[model samples]
Structure formats: C-alpha cells, structure tokens
Target: MKDTIKEKVASAVRSVYGIDASDAIEKASFEPPRKKEFGDVATNAAFILAKVLRRPPLEIARQIAEQLSGEKEFTRIEVAGKGFVNFFLSPRFYEELLKKIVETDFYVSDIGKKKKVLIEYVSANPTGPLHVGHGRGAVVGDVLSRVMALTGYKVDKEFYINDAGRQIKLLGLSIYYRIQELAGRNLTLPDDAYMGEYIVEIAKELMLKYPEIVDMEEEKAIELAAEFGKKVLLEEIKKTLERLKVEFDNWFSEKSLYNDGKVEKVLEFLKEKGLIYEKDGALWLKTSQFGDDKDRVVKRSTGEYTYFASDIAYHYDKILRGYDKGIDIWGADHHGYIPRVKAAIEALGESGDWLEVILIQLVKLFKHGEEVKMSKRAGNFVTLDWLMDEVGVDAVRFFFLTKRHDTPLDFDIDLALSEKSENPVYYVQYAHARISSILDKAKEEGIEPSTEHLNLLREEEFELILKCYGLKSTLESVAKKREPHLLPYYLIELASAFHKYYNKNRVVDTDSPELSSARLYLVSGVRKTIRSGLNILNVNAPGRM
Candidate 1:
C-alpha cells in the first residue's frame, strides 16, 4: 500500500512539473503524519524538488496535488504547511484492507527474495547451565532469525559451541576436584574452577558412572570428567532452550574444526597469504593492518593456537557452507572483538559486509523493586530455566526483546508476572482474547457477517482497519533495521486502539447489522495482527487468558 502511494505520488510529481522521473522521485519520502487530522500519509517530495524546479515548495506541492486530484486510493491530496503533501486515504481502501486480512492467511508485501543467511547466537560455553545473560542473546537471535524469515530470508539459526576451549577444561577439573572431595580425598581446586552446585551433582553422576576409574591418573581423570561434564552441560543447554522455545537449526562445535583440520587449514591459508608471521616463537596475525587495535597471537609459544585462531577457523567454515551472509550475535563484552574478526575475514579475501556482528547488551533483572544479580562464580545466578519458571516463555521472550538489541534492558520480574493493567504483554493478549470472545459471540448468535460487508465501516472502524494495513510496513521497517523490539511496541499501540474502540462501542448489537458486520471484520483484522506479531517474537497469543 505504501509503495502504491509512493508510486502514484512520484508519477504525479513528474507529470505536474514537466520534470524527469529521476528529478521528481529522488526526493520522495513517505511518512505518517503525527496528527491524523493532517492526513493519513504525508510526503516531502515538493520540499526536495523545490530548488531543482526553481519554484516555491508550496507552489510545487499545489501543482502535484492538482495532478493527483482523482487518484483511487487517496480521497484527497492537499498542500499543507511549507509544501508538505498530505494525503487522506479513501475509506474504501481501509475497508478493502479488512477484507483482505480475513480472506488471506498471510499479509502481502514485496519481501525480497530468499538469501541464505547464517545466524550464530547464544554460543555460550558449555561449562555450566545458561544464565540470564545468555538468555538475552538467545531471545534476540531467535527473534532476529524469525523476523528475517518473515521478510523472506532463508535463515539458519545456529549455536556455536565453545566445547574445546579452556573453559571446558576448567569445567572438567571442577568436576574432578568435586568428585575427589565427595570421596573424602584431599585435592586443591584451581581458582577458575566452576563453583556452581550443579558441578557437584555432575561429579556425583561421574563417580557413579566410573567407579573403577575413581583413583585413576590425573590426565585420565580429567579426560573422563571433561567428557562427562560436556555431555551434561549440553543436555542442560538443550533443556533450557527447549523451555525457552528457541530451536536452532544447527549446533556447530569448535572441536569439529580441530577434528576436521579446518583450523590448521585456515592457519595455512593465512600464512600462504602473508597474513601470518612467526615472531618470538609465536605466530601472529597482523590484525592491526586490517583496523584492529594491535596484532593478535594466533599460536602461542607453547605451539597451541589461541581461542581467537579457532574462532577464525570456525567463521571460515561458516563462509565455506555457501551462505550469502553470516551473522554473529554476541554479548556486549565481545564488542571489542568485532574489529579483529572483521579484519580476519577481510584478510581472507571475503567482503566484510558479508559478516555482521549483532552485539546485545546486558539485561538487568529486578524483582519487587530490588535488583537481582546473577554471578557464575557466586553460584547464585538465575538460569534460563529459572526465568522460564518465573514467567512463561511468552513473557520472558517478549520482555527480553522489548528494546533495541544494542541497548541495555531492565527486566522486571514482578511487572512481567503481573496480570493487572501494568503488564503490556497481558494487555496485548487481553485484546486478542477479547476479539476472540467477540467472534465467538457472533457465531453463537448465528450472525454470519461476510467480510465483503466491511465497505459499510465508519471512520472509527476504518481507523482500526488502517492500523492493520500498516503491519507490512511495520514489519519491513523492523527487518530493515534488524530491530525486533519494534514489534512489541507496535503490538501495544494496536491493542490500545482496539481496546479503546471496544469500550466505546458494542460489536454484537443486533439492531445495527451493518455496524456489527464491520466490527466483526475489524475484530478479525486485529486478531490476525496480534497473531502475526506474537509469532515473530516466538510467543503464543492465546485466544483465552
């Protein structure tokens, strides 16, 4: 619809001023008016073309309006203050929108062709259960993938496991010491050993599984415990993600890179390209040359590669999978690491534009107006599963994605759990349920109102229908900006409009059959919008509270 408006205005501007298409279309921008009375849609075409045409903006706007006098979609086009083109959409257009919503299962728009894009997110180390910090990234990445999919992108959601890093080693050792301590054996634990209580439970399971190897050599014990620990942690991660309703298309392992010689192959490729140099018994990647703060060590003096080297190899593997673009959703702490990763990709002869790193900031949790801090070392951190138990997956996902990914979020548990008016999620859901109730009542009364009768809608009914019509535009904006948070905000506004309309009018008034039919069409449109928004966020919009 917006595209139609832009095209019609472009043609009008070109014909009215006897200008070329390029000159007239270059300055066209379609925006919604702040005040509805001004018009439904407004444009700044005249303001942009005023200088080129050597005419006053108002004069140009008037000329464009005169040319667009009888357009079908628009009721009237007027030159407003300072040459703005204010367009009032015909009521029939919105009525048609309502009819379209009920007639189709999906909204129609030119969502670009499907491009293979890999999204790597929540690649949290498998050293322990996922905490709240990991939850934020999981939610963001999942919703981002969904939104991109809605925009007609072939999205592959993945979890890159850091199963071969030092963290996993520490986890193994943590389990080892815990097992020895439970057996009444004296052992000193490393400072970096995981202190969570789940470590002890894992140790107990390991001890039970490997009774014969309880007194084995340290190396054998570490190896056995690390294997067991990794299995348990992976299971926990799977469970947490399942509870959160986040499903990944793949779970890529860092260890796989080593097992397949991909890491060595990547290093060799860098060396062949003169991007790696041996200096002072260490292999270094000249990342500074590609805009890094300084050169980074790929291989240390001990002849083992750093974590960054493994990461580079893993990313290279993603590119080799034939994806048109790659996206890594990391936490804010890894923000500084983006530059070097991009540099490595550039050095590997790949366009940096193909690699996008979305950094989600921290999420601060609050309960009853008090801050809740979760620390891994303290072993008191709130796991993702705990959050799901506190608030259902719907609320958790919605709250996590209620802001821009780059901005820090404050998740108030009490607010989310509130069934009262303070909870926006509840409010939105209530609106959906209310519409469902109205539809049920209509069916119960045996009133089979056809959507084609929406043409009899009034100004208020059309206003609600217009809101539904803007869904495609809202979704396009969210996808283009990579901001899934906008969906929740828009849903809230939509619910408010519906609730206001419902409170002011009755939908099932038998005397006014025309109004009743129009209201039913509006109800169907609202329900469709709510369902679409919730699906994008991976939430369930229940028909009942």
Candidate 2:
C-alpha cells in the first residue's frame, strides 16, 4: 500500500516539476492521521519538495493534492497543517484490504532479503541456572531472532558457553571443595568459589558418579570437577531454556575457541597487525585506539585468556561460518564491553557493523507489593525456572517483553497470574479467544466468514482493520530498531481497539447475515494476526484462554 502511494506521488512530482526527484520521493512517507478529520493516510511530500520547486510548501501541497484528487485509490485528498497531504482511501480500498485478511492464509513480507544473522544471547556463566537477568536477555535475543526471520533474514539462534577460563576453574573448585566437605574433610572454600546450593547439588551428583575422585591428584581432581560442573550446568541451562520455550539453533562452546586454536589464531593476526601489545607480561589489545576507555588484556600475565579474548574468537567464528550479521544480547552491565568487541572485530579485519550487541537491563521480580526475595534453591536472585513455575511460560515471555530491553522491568508475580483484564498478555489472548468464539458460533449458525458485504464496515470498524494492517509495518520497525518490545505494545493497542469494537458491535449478527459475514471476515483476520504476533514473541495466544 505504501509502495503504491509512493509510486503515485513520485509520478505526480515528475508531472508537476518535469524533473526526477527520486530522493525527495523516497523521503516522502505517510503517518496515520492525527485527527480522524485528517483522513486515512497523511504525507509530507510537498514539504520535501517545496525548496526544490521554489514555492511555498502549502502551495505545493495544494497543487499535489489537486493532481491526486482524481486517483480512484483515494476518495478525498486535501492539504492541511503546513503542507501535509491528507488522503482518505476510497471505500473500495478498505473493503479490498480487510477482505484480503481472512481470504488469505498469511500475509508477510521478505524485507530481510535472506541476510544470515547469528543472534547470540543468554551466554551466562555455567555456574548455575539462569536467573531473571539472563531471562531478560534470552527473551530479547529470542524475539529479535524471530523478528529478523519474519523480516526474511536467515537467522540462527545461539548461546555462547562461557565454559572456559577462571570462571570454569572456580566452578570446578567450588564443587570439589563442596564434595570434600560432604566427605568429612572440612576444606575451606576459596573467596572466589561459587557459593550457590546448586554447586553442592552438582558436587553430590559427582560424588555418586566419581566416588574415587578424592584419590586423584588435586590438580587432576579440579579439572574433572570443572568439566563435570560445566556439563551439568550447561545441560540445566538448555533444559531451562527449553522449558521456557526458547531454543537455540546452536550452543557454541567457548572451550572450542581454545580447543580449535581460534583464540591463538586471532591473537596471532592481531599481533602481526601491530594491534596487540605486550604490557607487563600480559597480551593487551589496543582497545583504546578503538573507542575503549583503555587498553584491555586479551591474555593475562598468568597465560590465561581473558573473557574478551574468547568473545572475539566466538564472533570471528560467526564470521567464518558465513553469517552476514552477528548480534549479541548482553546484560546492561556489559555496555562498556561493546567497543572492545567491536575493536576485536575490526582488528580481525571485519567491519564493526558485522557485530551488534543489545544490552538489556535486569528484571526485578515483585510479589504482593514487596520484592520477592531470594532464589531458595540457587541462593541469590530469582531463577527463570522459578519464575516459570510461579507464573507461566506465556506470562514470563510476554511480561518480560512488555518493556524495552534497556529499561529495568519489575515483573509482577501477582499481576501475571491474574486472569483479569489488567493482565496485558491475558487481555490480548482474550481478544483472540473472543474472535475464535464468534467464528465458531458463526460456523454453527451456518454463517461462514466472507467478504460479502465489506462495504457495510464503518469508519470505526476500519480502526481495527487499519491496526491489523499495521502489523507488517510494526514488525519491520521491530527488526529495523532491533527492539522486540514494540511488538507487545503494538499488540496491546491492537487488542484494545478490537475488544472495544466487539463491545459496541456484533461480529456474527444473525439479523444481518451479509454484514455478519463481512464482520466475521474482519474478526478472523484479527484473530490470526494476534496469534501471529504472539507466536513471534514466543507467547501463547490460545483460541480459548
């Protein structure tokens, strides 16, 4: 629809000025009317062309409106608000579009052009199950992947395992000491050792499997402990994500970067480019030259690779895997880490544009007006599993996405479980359910959905139709902005308009069967659109919620 309007406007511009103004034509875009009196679609083409035409924008707008007045696509075209051209679509236009909804199986565009995207998210340390913090990043990455895929990108969901380095060694030591304590050896845990009860659980499980681990050398025992802990926690992470209905296309192991010599390979490349420097026995990347506040250690003095080094290798591996773009969903705390990673990408001779990171703020859980404290099992924050069992997977994904990624979200445990209209997710699902009920009832009454009398649809009915039509644009915006929160908000507004419409009008009125069929046609479209939007967010939109 936008393309049709833009093409006509481009033709009008040529006819009026006798010159090509493709750039201005491209700049011309439409906005929904600020007032119903302003008409269906409003554009500012004349405002863009005013200087080029050497005329007042308002005069140019009037001339353009005059030229377009004969267009059958628009029933009314008028100039208003400093050269804004308001266009009211012909009744035929709305009738055809609303009919297209239920008459078609699905409607989506190939806007992404099949660009391959690697979306790496929730790469939490395998120290414990994912908490609410990791859950936020998971949803962001997961939904972004869905959005990109819908926009026609070839997307691969991934979780990068931080299974190598000091953290892993500490994980092993934490479990080993816990095992020692359980075996009657009161070994003191190191200050940096993990302190979660899950660590003890892992230790107990390991004891049963490796009863002779105590007899092994200390260094060898810790290695075995670390490997065991990493495997267990990683499996748990996978299960938790699976339960949350968030699955990754790949689980790229950070240990592989070291094992496959990716870390050393990138390190050597940087060294030869003079991008890496040795400082006090540590190999440092001159990240300061690439917008970091200071140089960063890729490898510490003790010969252990830094987490940043592993991240570089992981991304380099992504590039080597033939992805056109790479996106990493990270905690907001890692905002400062973006530049160093970008620097590494550039140092590896890839454009920084190839890698983009979305930093998401943590989620805070609240219950009954007070902070829901403690993870009972994990010993600290709320785990994603706990939240899922408490509320539901649908509510968890929906509510987690109700706010922008950069904003801290306070998940209301009480609100999510509430079936009342105030629950946003439930409210939207109810809209779908209501439509399904109407369609089902219509089927029983022998009044099938059809576009038989679409002309009977009034202006208020177009409110829902237009909003449903906005879905494609909404999704395109989401993919372009790299924000998935826009989807829920759009859904909420669409659902609200639909529910309000249902309150005032009947979708399956037996008294007016033709009108009923048309309205049912619109309702069916609305239901499918809502379901599709929910599906993209990985939220459920049950036909009977």
Candidate 3:
C-alpha cells in the first residue's frame, strides 16, 4: 500500500514537472501524520524534489497535491506545513481493507525474505533458578522468534547453557560442602560459594542417592556433585520457562564445545591463521586487529580456557551450521562483550554483521508505589517462577515486553493484578472479550456480519478498520526493529480505538438492520485482529473478563 502511494507521487511529479524524479522519489517517505486532523498519511516527496527542481518546497507540495487530488483512494490531498502532502484515505478504501481482514489472515508479511535465523537468548548459567532478568530476555527472544517466523523467516530458538566454567565448579563446591555439613563435618562455606537454600536442597537429594560421597576423593566428589546440581537446576529452568510458555528448539551447552574438541580446534585454526599469539604466559587472540579495544586472552596462564574461547567456538559452530544470521540476547551489562565477539567472528573470516546482540536491561518490580527488592525463595534475587505464581504467565510475558528491551522497566505489580482499564494487558484482552459479546448478541438477534453493506460504514467504523489494518505493519516493524514493545503498544491503541467506538455506536440496533450488519462485520475484524496480536505475544485473548 505504501509502495502504491509512493509510485503515485512519483508519477504525479513526472507528469506535472515533465522531469523524472526517480532519484528524489527514493528519498520520499509515506508515514502517518503527527496529528489526526492532518490526515491518515503524509508524504515528503516535495521536500526532496525542491532541491532538484530549484523551487520552494511549499510550491512543489501544492503542485503535487493538486496532481493527486483526483486519486480514487484518497478523499482529499492537502498541502500541510511548508512542504508536506497529507492524504485522507477514502472511506471506500478502508471498507475494502476491513472486508479483506475479516475474510482472510492478513497479518503475515515477507519482511524477513525467508532468511534462516538462529536466536539464542536467556542462556543463564545452570547453577540456579532463572531470575526476572532472565525472564525479560526469554520473552523478548520468544516473541521475536515468533514475529520473525510469521514474517517469512525460518527461525530457531536456542538456550546456551553456560555449564562449563568456574561457576559450575563453584556450584559443585557449594553442594559438596553442604553435603559434608550434613554428614556432621564442621565446614564453613566460602564467601564466593553459592549460598542459596536451593544449594542445600540439591545436596540433600544427592546425599540420599550417594551415601558414600562424603568418603570419596574431593575432586571426584565435586564432579559428581556438579553433574547432579546441573541436571536438577537445568530441569527446573526448563520447567520455569515452560510455566511462562517460553520454549526453545535447542539447548546448546558450552560444555559440548570442549567435549567435541571444538574449542581447542578453533584456537588451533586461529593460531594457523596468525590470529593467535602468546604473551605473558597466556594464549591471546589478536582481537584488536578486528575492531576490539585490545587483545584478549583465550587461555589463561593457569592453562584454563576463558569463557570467550567457548563463545567463539560456539558462534563458529553456528556459522558452520549454515545459518544466515545469529542473534544473541545478552544482559545489558555485557555491552562491552559484543565488540570482542564480533571481533572473533571477523578474525575467523566472517562478516561482523553475521552476529547481532540484543541487550536486555534490568527489570525492577514495584508494588503499591514501592520497590519490592528481596525474594525469600531465591535467597538474593527474585525468581521468575515466584513472579509468575504471584501474577500469572500472561502478565509476566506481557509485562516484560511493555517497554523497550534495552531500557530498564519498572513493572507495577498492582497494575498487573488490577482488573481495570489502567492495566494494558487487561485493557487489550477486554477489547477482545467486548467484541465477542457484541458479536454474540448480534448473532442472537439473527444479525450476522456481512460485507455486502460495508458501504454503510461511517467515519468511526472506517477509523476502526484502519486500526485493524495496522496489524501487518506492526508485526513487520517488530521483526525489522527487533522491538517487541511495539506490538503491545499497537494492541493498546487498537483496543482504545475499539473501546471509544463501542461507547459511541450501537452495533445491534433493530431499527437499522443494514447498518447493524455492517458494524458487526467491523466488530468481528477488530476481534480477530486483537486475538491475532495477543497470540503473537503469547498472551490470551479471553472471551470474558
């Protein structure tokens, strides 16, 4: 639709000025005007052409508007401001769009162009339960995968388990020492050890299974403890994510890179390519040569590989798997980690653009205008499971995306639990339910939705149609910008439009059968569009509050 408008403006420019404005036309943009009174859509082609035509922008705009005045799809084309042409779409145009939306699945788009994409997110270490921070990334990645797949991209979701590092060793030690304490050994846990109560629980479970673990060698017992702790925590992580309705297609383990010898192999490959060097008794990668701030050590002086080494191997594995793109969703604190990873990719003869990282900031939960800081369950941090139990999976998933992922979000617990319109998720869901009731009441009166009398749709009905038509564009924007917040905002706006329309219009009036039928069709489109938007976000569209 936007392309059609751009072509019409280009043709108008050619016909009126007797000159091809192809180059300037490329700079033109058709977007919604700032104010509703301005029009439905506006173009800045005249501003782009003023430089080429050596005329005032206002003069060019007036000429273009006059040329496009007779367009069938536009009710009026008026020159606004100094050089903007605002187009008021005809009612018939919206009527046709609404009819199509009612009769078809019209929200899908080809914006992704069928590219194979791998989205890895919420790769939290398997040492403990997932916190709210992980929950935020989980929702972002999950929704993005859905949006990308709907937009013609073949996407696979992944969770990278960071189970092969100092953290895992510490987790094992934490549990091993707890078991020793259970066996009546006077052992004091180190300050760096995992102190959560869940650690003791894991130790208790392991103790029941391995009664002789206390007598085993320290190194061997720690390994056994680590394996048990990892398995138990990983299963809990999966269950928690499932509780929130977030599922991944793959659970890639960082340990697998070492088990498969890929980590050592990558280092050797880089060494052969002259990208690795020895310095200060450590093996370092020449990351600075590929846009990093400085060289990075892949292997420490203690003969242990850093996490960066495994990450490089993992991403190289992703490239070897033939994905067109790999998106990593990391915590916002890992902002500096991006350049180094991209550097690793470039050092390996791949374009830095092959890898994209989305940084998810922290989520601060609030209740009754006060920050709720502690969670008794996770010891120091709030767990995703506890939050879901407090509110619901729908609120957790929906609220996580209420703001831009890169920005910190202050989630209001009271608002989430509220049943009023102040709650965004509730408001949108209520719109779906309200429309369902309207349609049900219409059906009871034998006034079925019909597109035959769509011409009878008035200004408010056309306005609702235009809002419903925005679903496709919203999904496209979410896929392109990687911003899932736009979908929720779009849903809120659509619901608000519907609510306002419902408050003013009577859809099941017996005196006006034709108008009632036309309005019912519009109402049905709103319901379908709302349900579709909510479904993409993995939120429910309830038929009743």
RMSD values, in order shown: 3.1, 2.6, 3.3
Best by lDDT: 3
lDDT of each: 0.83, 0.86, 0.92
Over 4 Å off, model 1: 7-27, 34-38, 45-68, 79-84, 105-108, 374-378
lDDT of 1 by residue, 88-138 (tens): 989777766677766674453446468899989998888888988798899
> Per-residue lDDT for 307 in model 1?
93
In candidate 1 the C-alpha lDDT for residue 235 amounts to 86
Q: Could you tell me which residue pairs clash in candidate 1?
A: none
What is candidate 3's lDDT per residue for 40-157, written digit by digit as tens?
Answer: 8888888889999999999999988899898888899999889999999887778768877888878887768899999999999999999999999999999999999999999999
Stretches off by above 4 angstroms in model 2 are 10-24, 46-68, 79-83, 105-107
Candidate 1: count the clashes.
Answer: 0
| Residue-wise C-alpha lDDT for candidate 2, range 276-309, written one tens digit per residue | 9898999999878776778889999998888888
Query: Candidate 3, which ten residues in sequence have the lowest lDDT sum?
Result: 1-10
- Residue 31 of model 3 has an lDDT of 89
Candidate 1, residue 534: how far the Cα is off, in Å: 1.1
TM-score of each: 0.91, 0.93, 0.91
**Candidate 1 lowest-lDDT run of ten:** 104-113
What is the descending lDDT order?
Answer: 3, 2, 1
The better candidate by lDDT, 1 or 2, is 2
